[model samples]
Target: MGKIIISTNVSLDGVVQDPDGQEGFRLGGWFGQFGGKDLEAWAKISLEEAMGTEALLLGRRSDEWFAERWQSRSGEWADRLNSLPKYVVSSNLEQPRWSNSTPLTGDVVNEVSKLKQELDGDIVVYASYQLGRTLIEHDLVDELRLVVFPVVLGAGERLFGETSDKKPLRLVHARTIGDGLAFLTYQPVRDA
Candidate 1:
């Protein structure tokens, strides 16, 4: 069975919006400030993660964003991303234009639940805040991988929203990915 993993790049204050400045959010592109060894570390980690990912699960906005940027690029990273089976949660996108993409528009939780049981590797969720929150709320996320940056965007959307349930996470690993960056992995502690 594949594990549902939520991988996010967040600010010190938990802001996960607009790391590349594509979104019109005022605090967009906050993560672009890193350079030098930090950039190299980020790239290395991303490549490692991609190698282990079986498929990509994205929200509509992220699906569009990734397709627009990656479709025109060619490299090992881009090749891996373009070739992966991508699934998006969107009611409006009847047929996704992205290559090897599928739309999951009905009963997201149920659909993803089935996906988790059927697949053999990892289903990684990248920058899908709405979808991530829903998964978190329902306790469907098996692992949370956070690349925490140094800066803090006080006004942007956060990783965790207002949830009534108390989700306890056990830190499996923590290390410095680069200067002013921390890579942390947490496994959800489910009630048995």
Candidate 2:
């Protein structure tokens, strides 16, 4: 079965808001504020993840955001991302702007479960915080790969929100990216 992996970037304070500063958030653009070896290391890791991803799953806004930014880029990473099959979760999205994208209009849980059964590798979710919460609540997410930047954005959208119940995660790996970044890999602990 395909594993649904959430690969995202967040601030030290767990904020996942506009890292690019395009969303008008006061603390936006925390992603590249400090450019150095750490930023390069982060980009390298992100590229590796993209190379390994079998497909991409995103929410409507995230889909739009990525499409607008990546559609014109030309490189190995951009090529891989553009070529991968994309599934956008939206009931009202008439057409997806990204190449090789399909809109999932049915129930979120059911549709994602079906997607999981249909593929055999990593289906990475990038920058889709709302959809990430729903998947976590439904126990549909298999792994979470979080690259945490060094800044702390006290007030912004966080990677996690209130769920119906506590979701326990088992840490599989933890390391430092470059000098200031923390790379964490976690797996959802399922009850036996």
Candidate 3:
């Protein structure tokens, strides 16, 4: 089976919203707000990861947002993203604007589980907070790659909100980016 990976940018306090200041959250944009050589290196690594992903999983909001933006862009990364098959988890979105996009049309957990069994490549989920929470609750996430920034936002969307259970994670890899950001990779430990 293919792995379902969540790649998210979070703050020291676990906030994961509007890190780029494009989401209208005035208190956000903490990512490049304090820039350094390390930030550049971190960005490069993130881009590399995104490029390597074969398939993309996104929530309805993220799907619409990225579809509107990335579809119109002209670049190597944009080209790859546009060409990759995108699986969007949505209850309300009937049709997606992007090419090669499909909506998860059944029960969220069951449908995603079936998708996992059918897919043959890496499935990367990016910035889909609600879907991420649901996947985490359902024990569907295989790996979590979190790029933790040093800033601590007092209030915002968090990586882990109200969870159904205490999900145990084992740190498999960790590294500090050039700008003091910590790149942490974790895998969920199977319960005995």
Using lDDT as the measure, what is the rank order of every candidate, best first? 2, 1, 3
Q: Candidate 1: where are CA atoms >4 Å away?
A: none
Q: Residue 132, candidate 1: how far off, in angstroms?
A: 0.1
Predicted candidate 3 versus true structure: per-residue lDDT over 64-147, tens digit per residue: 778778888877777888898989988777897777899987788998898889987779998898899999999999999998
lDDT of 3: 0.86
Reference-based TM-score, model 1 = 0.96
Query: Tens digits of per-residue lDDT for model 2 on 30-86?
Result: 888943568877878889998989999999999999999999999998999999999
Off by over 4 Å in 3: none
C-alpha local distance difference test of each model: 0.88, 0.92, 0.86
Question: After superposing candidate 2, which stretches have Cα over 4 Å from the reference?
Answer: none
**Error at 132, model 2, angstroms:** 0.1
Greater-lDDT candidate between 1 and 2: 2
Please tell me which model should have the higher TM-score, number 2 or number 3.
Answer: 2
Against the true structure, candidate 2 has what lDDT?
0.92
- Residue 24 lDDT (model 2): 94
**TM-score for candidate 3:** 0.93
